[model samples]
Target: MPKQPYRFSYLLLTRLLLLWVSATFPAQAQSVYTQETALARDTVPSFKRHLPWLAAGAATVYVGGLVYLNHTWYEKEKTRFHWFNDSHEWKQLDKAGHFWGAFHESRLGADLLRKAGVSEKKAIWYGGALGFVLQTPIEYFDGRSPAYGASFTDIAANTAGSLAVIGQQLAWGELRVLPKYSFHRTPYAPLRPNVLGNGLSEEFLKDYNGHTYWLSVDLAKFLSPTSRFPKWLNPALGYGVEEMVFNDAAANRTLGLHAYRQYYLSVDLNWQAIHTRSKFLKSAFYVLSIFKFPAPALEYNGRQGWKMHGLYF
Candidate 1:
């Protein structure tokens, strides 16, 4: 993908986010139930032989991609120092995206280290904070790019995102409330396909109205042991925005459509809580877990009245 300056600079955070959001923390988190689970996880031996090739391979590809995006693909954008930009585009949907991306990515990074036999502390430091590391390099490129300035807000959000995971893992040894994401195709994509979704690829990236970031609380961890709640269930609170044909208010007014914030209450599944024998299936589930499994939802829009979904993703 070609870099669109501010547009695609931080998408890697999402890559990292999904990578781990499905997977939980490193080797430290002790499972409450099932012995087979323990054997599959937390039993990783040292991977010293693999580390050299793994590290070198990852660095080469990542650094090479950075150089290509900054100097080659987006060459015309020019290189020059720029000031802080809040962006505040897509009605702060991008900011929420950053938070969601960083949070998940940090956890995923930690999981990778754990899979490679790294200890909890080192994994937490590097893996849990990988979101910030992943983001800063792009920010470094942006700071030097004339097309977009380095955004202090973005940096702060990325830091907070990484910390949100690191702090929880260190304190609780597991996530009590996980950050999850869901998206539905919006009507606006048809109104302005170029801006919203020219293709399936662009839709997920640029269609702000199509995205929702959620805090899916695992009450099983927080509730009393005597409580009847199922361990596999989660209640989700979600945030989204719509009518953002333009990123700014004045620009959106030209289209005569008002922006509105959206809130959702829904049930979600904590797939990790479900026990299974196959390590491969568990691993697949962990990778797939960043997505909020479809469920019923109650929603309130800032402009429109309340609505309910029989099933919302």
Candidate 2:
């Protein structure tokens, strides 16, 4: 079966909406901190008056987004609860996306909770599980849709993402290994606009061929604080796929298209590590940390063997 583009679109839209709601509070709260006090402020918890507003706003967006999604994406379909095994689709790139979305969402949830003066233990457990909590319902919706069925692997990926954040917070008290994402325009989207995308915005969500998932490690975090290693630089491994205009192997082969996975060796920027006193910059970096910064990359794929990009997003 061809993969449903709406699934990816729904994830992307929900992620963005949650991020916007989460980010707004921290950005506004930035006005109270000075450079000397910023680090100290983060470590201490004090219940803020705005936490109620934050909770209300997030809840509103969560419910509102679901209502909108059901109306726009699921209303026309005849649906009944069912399970789907899409573990093989899109070379598991969609699973990578699920992991990325859940990781960042969990990270945001924890950060927001911490900022709102929630206890450390509560924040770690609750906020760290936020991504899974948010994404699992969409699977329920999928289960009922004739076009898409609930995927066990998708739930597993979401769980892994949340666990990645939860485990790090419990052990290291901060994230050292980050899951990130990057994208570029691809010609393949025009080949099937309905499934891939029709425009830049839709393409970004639906076109798996243009998407790359990265795992970036902060080397400085492991080294001595006195070490001279650049705090902002990280070594990253990336995974991507190309030539997959159709999710079905037979469908792709009929058109002489073959899908192959690509691996990348690249460097990334740890935006949060960069020193900045500005509250807006701090908030911006926190949000932007989910993206892999453009840099020279070495890529290897079965078809191409090895190739170098001047810069790869």
Candidate 3:
């Protein structure tokens, strides 16, 4: 099986967190009524009383998941600490991915904490830290692995991702720029299954050749409130790569292909901007907000020609 790192850690944690929040919702319902009526919330549900158990359970799951990741990702052989400068690979595209993942995880964790009644400052800080916590454990194991070692660049990128969210929120009290991603099948992916991945599920994570990460900045938020910028529209800047079957330039020469950086200017829909009376629709949009809405784009590559995308995200 091909390696699919980074995907499992966050997806699992988010699901567990959602479950945890859902389970605690009933207990918090009384507080909602109290706030509406200006009355004190005097009764605590039995479930809330046992929340320590839920916390313990969450800890157990996290530990188990980390252990499993270490066992599965690291070989039995012992290896010394080492480092990799993956900044060379994919024309620094993977770094964009690191930032992308870290940003979402940090933001989601913070939002989830807020929903759980954590203080805003604590939620943002803890959520930002959680991104590093989730990502760094793999590095400890990586440092010991002969096949893969800890990369300071990755850690830096992860911190950037987390702090990017924290900084934005602390400054403006809302996210003006959001990290988003989109992908399309590429010929390069099938050529190196062991590294790039063999299937759709694996390829999405491992195939840097196919992934495009974006920073979707809300134009409406940036402009003066009275400006004519559409509130629902976001102008996105994107980073990606082309023809990167190998990590280094020399290897790519053998295939008669040059790996180059691709830059994109695109438009995306800010789904969260949509206002609606239906709670279900709002929740659904929120759930799907992680994805950038597909729209037309124009791209410029490093010494590659200018190109147009009729539908891009």
Candidate 4:
């Protein structure tokens, strides 16, 4: 009978020991979950977060290959049809000249921001403003380049381009909301020789009013990281449209207008090498293509536009 009491005591002690063991190591309870996961039976949704980057990676590879092939063609014959635009180049200290230079680049800057996911209002105004402000150094650099010098005409064109970009964004409502399609409206401008006549300088010509509009399409593909910089360079191919409208003073009101149309295309390859994530670098070297495509119509002018050889962002 005394043994029966001892047996009960032993049973109680056993239960107490188990309780203490469980309390001492709570992780053992979670072991089952970890083991199941280790066995590849996990049902959690962790992979969903990385899906977008994976897709971007695959697309980058495909597009990078295509861009490389196009780049080769641009290099082969870029120098033959080159332009000497000394007229637009200007000095930095010259206040009026600097503003014009900024204006032209700003127009292009708006187009850049639109492509890089900036909203229409900010993209246009900000881009135009930046273009004018930032391009001053480039003009100054041009003065130093051995092959090319500075010109006031280039600055003016830059300003015009900037205004055009901002104006287009403001004028079109959907463009602010939807960029890809909004920028599709072929941007156009006319380029006329600073001369007084329309290819007939011999004839009596009057002060003419002419214009030039440039259109460009921007495409991008992000690549996987290879070395120090991100492994992608976004290259854009731009097709240009040139139109000129001049007045004929000699023919009275009967022959009032003279017009000319020319076509131009350019390619640029851009890489964000230094400060790739920085806002300024992104804005600076965003597009890498800068070789103009040859067109028979533009040949009459005898020179191609500026070519983008290489850039560091």
Candidate 5:
């Protein structure tokens, strides 16, 4: 089966819009701080002023995005509501993209709420669920399209991503494990430009072979406060897929291509840990935090026993 092009484009647009909104608005002054300080900051009258504007902006984007998608994409192939089982598609690489997208969206929602003077408990619960709220509705749009249908697995991945943010906030009062993404151009795209993508920008979202989802662990967080370990350094595990010109195994095999999974062990940078008082730099770091930094990596795949990269993106 071929992949849905609109699905990839929709995800890419949604993420970019959300990132823009997050960067345009001011985030909480500090990324790492005590629970008490967080609560106290919410009491500031000035912070409450942003709540209405933020709410309005978010609502506008939500409705506007759906309208645009409906006209541009869904209208081309309207259908009765249906279900799609894409659990096995793209070697589950698409699922990883969903997880990564939802996680960052949820994180941004929570942080934006905190900045708007919402209480810690409310922000943690309501804001943490924002990613699920934002992404799930698109499944309805998908269900109505003949080219695609509502995917249960996609919903599950979205839910898990939201829970990840909520769980960390409730347990550790901060994010210790961060979901990040990295991409590199691949020759596979040329084989199926219409499906994989035609250019760098499109391939960034549509090319599963180029995508790598990572879980970056903040090791310094577990150490004592006085420990000299670099707080900005982290260890990360990554997952990717390769040699897939088509979603179906048989189709790819007919073309002499075999899909294989890739696992990676690498180092990442904790951009949030770098102390900075500049609001612009802080926002930049918050947006950049969603990506895994390129570093030396060890990789393993069933097709190729083991491999190493001096610097893997």
Candidate 6:
């Protein structure tokens, strides 16, 4: 009985010692496996991830929105407005204005592509192409609306805006461009004439050499939203930092420009354009009244201000 007790104690001690050793040198835990993770979408879907789903959804919504817009206008919903339609004149491809406009649109498209996880080159190309292609469909809808006749010049402007964006990417691919200058609202006081200020900003630049782009952070504030904003808003703001890089060789080269250059910030402001009622027929379909067109905008930067222009949406 005494021998048997000793043997049991020794066995117990050995087991305890083994457990301690195992605890001291633990193995690395295996990563979780899932389709989204395996496909490189940790939490969100990539542009390529679930592409069929997105394609179906985007196509459905885009076409549906167009049809709805037309239907409502046809039914006399009186729910559309164009703040800038009359302010700008149209010039075709030969016009310098066309180039600038298209360049801007391309930049906008590229930015969207980057968020969708596309490579920078693809982003720029896709953005420019999207900017150009999106206009035709929009123009078709406009032509169908009795309240709003399709203007060839307007479609041309859209194309020009997109081309301007592409040109900008080609010229300055280092910084991701944002709307550096734009005006929201109207005269400071409509009763008071000659008040010319209306939310203007300058000293901003974006350059992309296929790999990296640089932007002034301080100025990015008025043009971008914060992280809390919806990802779709694509909020961006910073003071000074190394921007995203797509090419190591291009970023490392010293071309007289600072590895990261700097720019001053300037912005001006004036009156407000307030719309009191829902103008578009689609506005009434919103579950919440807030979704209606011409809903009050308590605070707006120029980017959001662009939404006020019915054609831009």
Q: Which candidate number would show the highest TM-score if scored against the true structure?
A: 5
TM-score pick, better of 2 and 5: 5
Per-residue lDDT of candidate 1, residues 3-112 (tens digit): 23235534643474344434332332332324664565545544445556656765676677677776653567656777656655566777777787778778777766
Better of 3 and 5 by lDDT: 5
TM agreement with the true structure for every prediction:
0.87, 0.92, 0.82, 0.25, 0.93, 0.35
What does candidate 4's lDDT look like per residue over 232-311, in tens digits?
33222222222222222233234343333233333322232233334344433422211112222221222444433232
Q: lDDT for model 3, on a 0 to 1 scale?
A: 0.69
lDDT tens per residue, model 5, 66-117: 8888898778778899998988788888888888888888888888787666
Worst 10 residues of 3 by lDDT: 25-34
- Candidate 3 lDDT by residue in tens digits, 1-313: 1123444454455445644444343222111232522322233244345556766776688778777766765657658887755554457776777787677667766765555556778878896676676666666776777766677877898899899988987887778898888877788877877777778876776788788888888888778979998888898898888888887677878988788888899988887777664546555565556567788999998675899999974
lDDT per model vs. reference:
0.71, 0.83, 0.69, 0.32, 0.84, 0.33
RMSD of 2: 3.2
Q: Which window of 10 residues has the lowest lDDT sum in candidate 4?
A: 176-185
**Which tens-of-lDDT digit does each residue in 1-313 have in candidate 6?**
0011111222223223323322322211111233522443332344446435644654565566556655643445333533223222211211222223334334444644554556667876786765456444544544444445445565565576666556655665533333222212322222111121112211111112111111212233234455343222222221121221212225334332222322212221110011223323212211111111221222223223211222110
lDDT of 2 by residue, 1-313 (tens): 5546777656776677666865564432211245654664664443366667667877887788888888887788856799999998889998998899888888888877766666778878898898898888888888878977899999999999999999988888788999999999999999999999899988888889999999999999889989999999999999999999988888899879999999999999988777777767877887788889999999999998999999997
Off by over 4 Å in 5: 1-3, 29-44
TM-score of 5: 0.93
- Which candidate number has the best lDDT? 5
Worst 10 residues of 2 by lDDT: 25-34
- By summed lDDT, which 10 consecutive residues of candidate 6 come out lowest? 202-211
Q: Judged by lDDT relative to the true structure, which candidate is superior, 4 or 5?
A: 5
Deviation in angstroms for 151 in model 6? Answer: 1.5
